[model samples]
Target: MLDFPNWQNWIEKPSSIIKKLRQKLDQMVGVEIKLAEARSGPPTGMALNLEIRGEDFNQMSEAVEEIKQKIKNIPGLVDLTDDFDRSRPELKVIIDRDKASRLGLRARDIANTVRTAFNGKKVSVFRDGTEEYDIWVQLDQSFRSNQSDLSSLFIYTPSGEPVRLSEIARVDSGPSYGSIRHVDTVRTITISADAFRMPGPVLVMKTKQVLNKLDLPQGVTYQFTGEDENRKESQIFIGQALIIAILLILVVMVAQFNSIALPLIVISSVLMSVMGVIIGLIVHDRPFGIIMTGVGTVALAGIVVNNAIVMLDYVIKLRKKGYQRNEAMILAAAVRFRPVVLTAVTTVLGLVPIAIGMDIDFSRESIILFGAASASFWKSMALAIMYGLGVTTLLTLFLLPALYSLVEGGKERLRGLFSSKEIVY
Candidate 1:
C-alpha cells in the first residue's frame, strides 16, 4: 500500500496519477491491477459489478467473456475482469460401469480408491503428549504425477481382488474452473471494474449501452451489483426521505399558520434553496453527491423556512394591529431585515471554512486550507446548506413579502366579490 501527502501538496490530481500508473502497468505482461479510491460508507466491492447467472457453466463462461470484450474498451474503465476461474487444470476419472460391474467393483468403490490414492484418507490417530494428529495414507507425488501413472494404479474389488485401474476407468486432463459461485442456488459469474476519471454512473451508463448488444443464451440473465447497485438504492432512499420530510414540514407549517397559502409561501423558500444548491454545484464543478447533498437538501427544507416564517409571522402580527397590508409588509421587512440577514450570514460564515476544507491548528498557530479528508467528504453538504440558505434568505426578505401582499389582496378581492353577489341568492 502507498500513502501520499495531503491533497494540497500534490502537483497532479489523484485521477491523473492513477491514469498514468494504469498506462505503465498495462504494459506489463500477464498482470492485472485494480486501483480504487478510499471512500467512506459500506464497502460495495467494486465500482462496476455485473453478475451473469445461468444453469449451464459453458454458456455463462461464454457470456462472461463476450461481455468483458465489449466493455474492456470503455474509456475511464479500469481493471476489467471477472470472478470466473478458468485457468485451473483438472483430471477427470471416467468409470466404465460395465467393466466395473464385471469386475465385481461398484462405481463408489472405484471412486473411493481413486480419491484415497490421490487425496489421502485419514486412517488412524497419532498421539504425542497431549496433542494428536490424524495419519493419512496416499501415494507419493512421484507415483501420481501423470495420467500414465494414475492408470497404472491398483484398485480392490468387494471380493478382495486387486485389479488395474486402466481396465475399468480412463483419466483425462483438461482445464477446469477453480471455483464456482452460486446465488440462490444458481451459478453466477461476476464481472467487476473500477472507474478512473469518469463517475461511476457515467461508466455504468456507457457499459449498459454496450451490454444492450449482448445476446444472452436461454435462461441466462444479468444484473448490476456492487457500488452501482448501492448508489441507485441510496438515491431512491434519499428521494423518499426528502419527500417525507417535505410532507412533514408542510403539515407542521399548515398547522402553525392555519392557512394553506402561508405554508405554501414558506415552502417556496425550500424550492429556492434547491435551486441554489443546483446552481452552486454547477458553478463549483462538483458532482451532486447523492447521499450528502440529498440529506442537506432535506435539512434545508426545515431551515430555509425559518426566515420566511419569521417575516410572514411579523406581517400577520402587524396586520392585527390595524396596519394596512402593504404597510404591514414594508414594516415587517424593515423590522426583520437585520435578524434575517444576520442569521443567514452567520450560518454561511460558519460553513465557509468547512466547505473550503479549512482548519486552524492551535499548536502550530497556522491555518490549513483544503487539507482535511473528512472536510472534503462533508463539503457537499456544507455547500448545499450555504448556497441554499443564502438564496432562500434573499428570497424570504424580498420575494416573500411581495407574495404575501399579493395573496392577501387576492383574498380581499374574493371576499368583496362574494359579499356583493349575496343579493342574487
Candidate 2:
C-alpha cells in the first residue's frame, strides 16, 4: 500500500487487481485491506444506512452484524464494512449521589480528580528558545491502569477530609466508541462497500432484493443513500424533462403541420425509434441512466421529428395538388428516400467513434492522462442516437406512410358515420 503508482500500465482493470489483493488479505482472520477507489468527483461507493432509534446498543450492534452478513453474500458487492469497532474498551465512572452527599463530597470534585489523574490536565507551557511544550501533571500510569487503583485515588471533601473514590463512585468497564455519529438529528450507522463491475443502479437493485427478505424489527429502518439515491433522483428528473420535451415537440409539430392528425403520425415515428435504441443498449449491456443516454434520448426526440416532417410535408403538398391519399404518401416516401438515408448515415457515422470509444490506448501512450476506468462515458449517447436514427429513417419511409393512410381512412369513416342520413323504420 506504500508508494503506490498514481497511474497503472496494466491491461487488467485496477478494481480487479485490487479485488485479488483484497481476497488475499481476507484469508487471514481480522486482517482487512480497504481498497478505497482513488477517483475524482463524488466517491464511488454504496451505503446501506440503518437508523436505530432505540437506546439499546447491544441490540443495534446485533442488527448491524446481521445486515453485514446479508450484504456480504451479495454478488458484485466488495469491501463490505459495518465500521463498528468492538475492540476498544472503556471505563465509565458512575458516581453515587447519595453516598457522595453524605460524604460531603461534590460530584464535580470526583470528576475533576479522576480527569486530572487519567488525562493529566496541562498546568503550564514549558518554553525553550522558540520551541514550546505542554507541561501536564498527573499520577503515574500504574495508578490509572485498573479500577482498584483508580478507586484508591483520594478526593477531598469541603471539610478537608480525604475520601477514597471507592466510597463515593464505582467504575464499570465495557466496549464503547470515543464518539457517536448523528445524521439529520438521528443516530445512524452506515454499512457501505465498493461496487465492482456492477453499475450503481444494478448494485442498489441486488442489495434491495437481499434486504426485502429480512423482516426488520420495529424502530429499525434502512435507507439507500450515496450513488443509488442520486441515480434514482436523476432518473425521475430526466423522465420529467423528456416528457416536457416531447410535449413541446408535439406543440411545434401541430403548429407546423396545421393538422392535429398529421402531427400524431410524425410522433409515432419517435416511438418507433425507441426499439432500435433499446436493441443497441441490450446488445452492449449498457445501463440507461448514465446521464449521457438520457441526453441522447432527448436529442433523438428532436432528430426523429425532423425526418418525419420532411416526409409528411411532401405528402401534404401532393395531396393539395389533387393526388389520391395513398398514391401521394407512396410517392412522397419514394422521393425522400435518398435524403433521409443520407442524413441518418451521416449522423450515425459522426457518433460511431464516441460509441465505440477512441482507438487510442491510454495505458502505454499516456497512462497519467487517462489514468484508468476506460473512455466510454459518451458511448451510451452515441449508441442511442446512432441506432435510433437508423431505425427512425427506415420507419419514416415505410411505416409512416401506412400509418398516415390508416389515420386518414379512419377520419373519412368517422365523417361518413356522422353525416349520413338516418334510415326511418
For this target, which candidate reaches the highest lDDT against the unseen true structure?
1
What is candidate 1's local distance difference test score? 0.86
User: All candidates' TM-scores?
Assistant: 0.93, 0.83
Off by over 4 Å in 2: 1-16, 36-43, 47-55, 120-149, 359-373, 422-425
lDDT of 2 by residue, 233-310 (tens): 778887898889888988998888788988888888879878888988999999885477888888898899899999
- lDDT of every model, 2 decimals: 0.86, 0.78
In candidate 1, what are the lDDT values of residues 154-182, reduced to their tens digit? 99887888889998999899999899999
User: In model 2, what is the error at residue 64, expressed in angstroms?
Assistant: 2.5
Candidate 2: RMSD to truth = 4.2
Q: What is the lDDT of residue 354 in candidate 2?
A: 68
> Cα deviation of 34 in candidate 1 (Å)?
1.7
